[model samples]
Target: MSNIIEKNVDLLKKANVYFDGRVTSRNYTDKDGVVKSLGVMLPGEYTFNTKAPESMEILGGKVEVLILSGLDNNWETYGAGETFEVPGNSSFEIKVLELADYCCTYLS
Candidate 1:
């Protein structure tokens, strides 16, 4: 609770629960009912399986991602303040260039 504040209703710590301890996140819902997660990733390559459309924003550092349904040629690079979208029922691969910080929204 110390690291949380008002309306920051969800907090998910990296306690080896998901992604084999590779990722950690804090979930919250805004006033408009938009659900989002603020998360961090260590320097590494990661693949995420998606069941719903997702919008991702990079908060710090950079990453190269391969979204099978979107990008054509090769992995695309995204840096701080950059964003991208991935479709539902698909998968995306991400390579973190640094300690990547990000926010992700699941769209219905």
Candidate 2:
């Protein structure tokens, strides 16, 4: 069996609060067997467009965003701390209004 490890932001030596900055993360896998990450924009707006794998799912988040998925015609606005699940073989584009933070997690 594979050993499970849990990392807390409070206990991490590299974790620090950002007041007004933007941070982009590379792709990473989470403990829940999900590919999870975030693109943080402090006090400024940002946009992201990507093609997620078929099995990808948007678990939850807290930020205002416009979601344009291949499966949907109109854009979906996700409120603060919202959750979404993605279908297989789909693509999406996201746009954020104002300064916002978002969390993305994918399952394999």
Which pairs clash in the backbone of model 2? Answer: 54-88, 54-89, 61-81, 62-81
lDDT of 2 by residue, 44-90 (tens): 44444345532322223334443445544665666445555554345
For candidate 1, which ten residues in a row score worst on lDDT? 1-10
Q: How many residue pairs clash in each candidate?
A: 0, 4
Error of 1 at 76 (Å): 0.4
In model 1, pairs of residues that clash are none
Off by over 4 Å in 1: 1-17, 70-73
Residue 46 displacement (Å), model 2: 7.3
lDDT, model 1, position 101: 80
lDDT of 2 at 10: 22
Judged by whole-model lDDT over C-alpha atoms, candidate 2 comes out at: 0.45
Q: Residues 16-78, candidate 1: write the lDDT tens digits.
A: 234765687777775567777888898889888889899998988889999977547478899
Whole-model Cα lDDT of every candidate shown, in order: 0.79, 0.45
RMSD of each: 4.4, 7.2
